[model samples]
Target: MNQHKKGLVVWIGIVLLLLAGALLAGPGDRVETVQETMRDAVLHNVNRISLLGLKEVNPGLISAFLVTIILLIAAALIRIFAVPRFRYIPGKLQLLLEQAVGLFDNMARGASPHRFRFVGAYIFAAGAFIFVGTLFELLGIQVVTVGGHPITLPAPLSDVNAAIALGTLSYLVILSGGVAANGVKGVGKTLKEFSLPISMSFRLFGALLSGLLVTELVYYYVNLSFVLPVVVGVLFTLLHAVIQTYVLTMLTSMYYGEVSEPSPPKPKKKKQASSPAEHA
Candidate 1:
């Protein structure tokens, strides 16, 4: 009706036309499926660890261990170097560290208002791991396998076993909070969930793996590779990193609150009133 409305209508028609053209475009020579994307990687058995008569360990286990070590060393460096230099007037690094810590601390306090003391550090540690480990893969760091093939190390949570380990550890932290606040009753109550570890594990694994698979698909197809995979892959990784970090921390704190909260006492029934005639 108006000039502005006409412009909007023109834009919508242009977008729809582009979509139709793209859909009608003939199939490319290369085809990709989820299974093919997943199976093409040399992920699991690449660099097997053989130690002391043991059969062999998975490469993902090694990645998890390496990530843990890196986290520990970084923490130690910050404590030794950064803590000594902290001043009243905070700079960029100091401000960032304090803010990051404060965010999780606030989440912990908000979720478990009464029992944050027990789970604050646990939540912080888990959040840091998920956030940092996801980003670590973007470095494109490669490790050579025993079989002489080089493969980029994936985020530990990308591996099912490592995801299971991470989930189990978080569940244990929650269980410990319950036990601390409610005694033996806490452990039983936490265990009642029974499937928390498995659910957490698969949720994390699925999210990370889907991102990995999509990125792989983009790279696998030559037509889609130019400049697009970097954008798509980075976006997916960053989204999963932030999302999974928040999800796990939120769930851990919420469950800890449920398990640690003191059970409310039942109200007693009111006494029946006696009539004057009955009393006489």
Candidate 2:
């Protein structure tokens, strides 16, 4: 079945990503002589490697920040115009976004109406993931300006860890909300909701992360070995964009449907009537 195949592919991708992250970020993966010499001359002051520390001295961090801002603005525009209205889709961008929105709406209808509120959060989280991925790639390109040297990024958390954390938390919230909204009757159904978000979010994060890591790994190994970087880079970036958009909108609709369920109506307020004499 298609669903089974999809699940298999996702799990395989997750495994590959874990291996890649461990290979690249493990304790023994220290900078070699060339990288150390370059850093010594250009970035000797860089002592610590925390997120905040990197941001203060690294141009890549500034670039990442700017790119994040741009992504947020684009996401805002998409949310405001494209998503809610379901407007026309002529260009490739609009067409792509329309497909994602359609999938998300289907998910929303299946979840609770109140859960629909979480569409915004999913959009934000997904967009953030994509922006981060693209920013890393762009920074890699920028490193070429300095004599085609390799540049390292300040990895916030391992891809596997992030995937697990993001997926588990998102699912728990969705499952809990759906269960509470449906009262005690649909406990089983609500419990089932947990896996959907978890799997969806994890699959997406793993795919994107794997794409990024693979690109960097390939470039590292085959920079001038007749392995065309442009083609490979473009391919991975394209895949990343498409996958991120799909995941973002799909999760949004899933959460939206969960939270969008209508609550039971309360008794109408009895408006005090005017005196009968005044009416007569």
Candidate 3:
């Protein structure tokens, strides 16, 4: 084999040996089922919600709140430091931000040519939230459970409630677009698709839940947990993040376009010359 091929083979063999050793030496622990792995435990009970009133402060909400704060701080820092430092040639971060803005703006325009102006920013914001929130779990930030067990915080969308909120919120944003573009007619048009929020919410929940469950299942087994957890978790998380972000953004943009579309004017009747008999 060539030198490069030999080096690659050596690395592969080393990795395989390490994996084998880890797997063989691992303690054989019983695996947790999908249901058990997927459930979010309470960190601590907070004030009453008054609506549902379960009492446990949702870890999903806490995670989402942290993500939101991170996003806001990043935005603020970018505006203060990055924006001011941007030069004529454009640095990496500035270029990336500009490109992202341009991409979402283009998608908004393509989805709703006439009414995109009303909802473009909303689409961009929603896309950002979904993408960031989906990958938040990879940060491995730990939160103490009410039972005193510390666990890595799960992504917000992995929680059904948070998924539902995001879905409903996206639908509302689309509705607002409709209202802005067509007023009462827009409202009526948006309300026509009553099942939208539920579907959206469930879809987000299902996709994220699938990824979470898969990763958890991988980690639940000692043998599989060796080097496989990292691979499985990352692949699932990245896959879900990209897929869900695109799906939600596309759906929102399409629906917004549909509701905001202006009705075509009816053709006017031709004012023909009077018939000869009528004139006579």
**Number of the predicted model whose TM-score against the real structure is largest:** 3
Candidate 2 lDDT at 116 equals: 54
Top-lDDT structure, candidate number: 3
Model 2 agreement with the true structure over 1-280: per-residue lDDT tens digits: 9999999999999967766775665344445544443443233234222345333334334334555666679889988876676645466677876555555554554543455545545654555555464545544433321333444542221244444555666566555555666655335555656567557656755565565555545544532223345555666676666666656555645664544354567899999999999899
Model 1 has an lDDT value of: 0.79
Per-model C-alpha lDDT, please? Answer: 0.79, 0.53, 0.79
**lDDT of model 2 at position 259:** 44
Q: Candidate 3 residues 1-280, lDDT tens each? A: 6999999999999989888987788765433344554453211132112223454556677778888999999999999989988888988998999988887888889999988865678878878888899899888888765555566777888777888898999899889888888899899999999999999999998888777777766766656876677777787688778889889988999999999898677899999999999988
Question: What is candidate 1's lDDT per residue for 1-280, written digit by digit as tens?
Answer: 6999999999999967765665566445543354644674425654555433365555566666777888999899999999889989998989998998898899989998879976888888889888888887786667765555566777777777878888898899889888988888899999999899889988988887777777767755555654576687787789889999999999999999889888776798889898999989
**Candidate 3: 10-residue stretch with minimal lDDT:** 42-51
Which wins on lDDT, candidate 2 or candidate 3?
Answer: 3
| Candidate 3 segments exceeding 4 Å error | 1-21, 24-35, 39-55, 266-280
Candidate 1 vs candidate 3, TM-score winner: 3
